[model samples]
Every structure is written in structure tokens, then in C-alpha cells.
Target: MGDFVKKLKTLKTEVEAEVPNHPSIEMGDVICEHFAISKPEEKTVNNPTRASNKENITEKERNKRRKSEKEKALGVKKKQKKPCGFCGEKTNLHTKTTCPKNPNARRMPKPKVS
Candidate 1:
């Protein structure tokens, strides 16, 4: 019985000595929790060539997209006309009347022959 008591005491002392006085949370534990919550490894489903004909888009759809882009580039949404640099009057590229470089340009008179 005395031997048993001594062994029990020794075991208790050993366990106590190994126990931490004030155990702090480890950074690895927090990192594991963050990974579990965020789940950054989830797969995405975007196609690499979806924006172009490589994705099997119909011809009509492609034409429509092209037209939409052209209209946007030409500022078709706004009706206000841009002024010509020379004329100071609103004119589009298709029907510009006066050259912007010389608003008051006049043809020079031809030199009289001697």
C-alpha cells in the first residue's frame, strides 16, 4: 500500500510539472479557424474564352454585341452635337462643312498672267 501511494504521488507530480502555468492560444489554431471560415479553395466556373467566339456564341448575338459597342463609341445615347473646330457649329464627322484649322478660310485669288 505504501509503494502504491508513492507511485500515485510521483505520477501526479509528473503530470503537474508538464502542465502549462498559463497556456496561450497558438497562431496555428487561429489560422486553421480562418481557413475553415473563409474556404478560399472553392472552385470558380468562369470560362476563359467566354467573351469571344471561342465560347460558341451565335452569329446574331455577336453582331448585336458589336453594334452595341459601336453605338457606345459614337456616343449615340446623347443627341447633343459636337462643334466643328473651324466653324464653331455643331457637326458630326460625317457632315463637317468647314475645316477646323481655318474657320474664316477663303480661296486665294489666282495670279494674273503677264
Candidate 2:
């Protein structure tokens, strides 16, 4: 246990010595020195007409934009149909379980051996 602890301490010191100055240490010190320096400037708008004009988008354009934005944000993609293994037909309608050309449809039980 003592040897393990000694090895761990030596490893920690070696790592600290290898990385004498890291960006994280400097960033932490910079952040501590100027905590509120990164705050965004507040803008006060006096003209209500200008603000309304900025938001004057058509209903159809707004709907189209919203739909496109939603599709992009949700990562919506068109599904590609895969060809059937048995029939070689490209379809998204039927699966292997409901495929008409499935070989297992007319399968019979194997004969029991003594």
C-alpha cells in the first residue's frame, strides 16, 4: 500500500513537471482576475416602429422558414428503400416477414430420427 501510494505521488509530480504551464491554468487565473469582463453589452431600443418593421415577415415565408429550420434542427432525412433479397424489388412497403417470395413460407417440419 505504501509503495503504491509512493508510486502514485511520483507519477502525479512527474505529470505536473512535464506539463509546467497549461492553457487551463492560465484561463482559470484570467477568469478569476476579470470575472465580469465577458458580459455582453445591453442595447436599449427607443423606436417601436423599427422593431415592428424588423419582425414584419409574411405568414407564408415565416411558415416555410420555420419548417426548414425545424427539419434542419431535427436532422430529418428521406429514407432510401432497400431491394428485396429474394425478388430484387426496391420497396419500403413490405418487410422480410410479410414478403410474398420468402422461402420459409412453404417450409415443412423435419422428420424425427430414432
Alpha-carbon local distance difference test for all models: 0.58, 0.59
Rate residue 30 of model 2 by lDDT.
Answer: 78
Each candidate: RMSD: 17.2, 24.8
After TM-score superposition, the amount by which residue 42's alpha carbon in candidate 2 deviates from its true location, in angstroms, is 14
> Candidate 2 lDDT (Cα, whole model)?
0.59
TM-score of each: 0.21, 0.23
Per-residue error for 47 in candidate 1, Å, reads 11
User: Using TM-score as the measure, which candidate wins?
Assistant: 2
Give candidate 2's total backbone clashes: 0
**lDDT, candidate 1, 1-114, per-residue tens:** 999999999999999899867767688768878787543476777667545534456767766544445565566535566776555656443223344455454533223222
> What's the distance in Å from true for residue 105, model 2?
89
lDDT score for residue 61 of model 2: 74
Q: What is candidate 1's CA lDDT for residue 57?
A: 60
Q: CA shift at 56, candidate 1, in angstroms?
A: 16
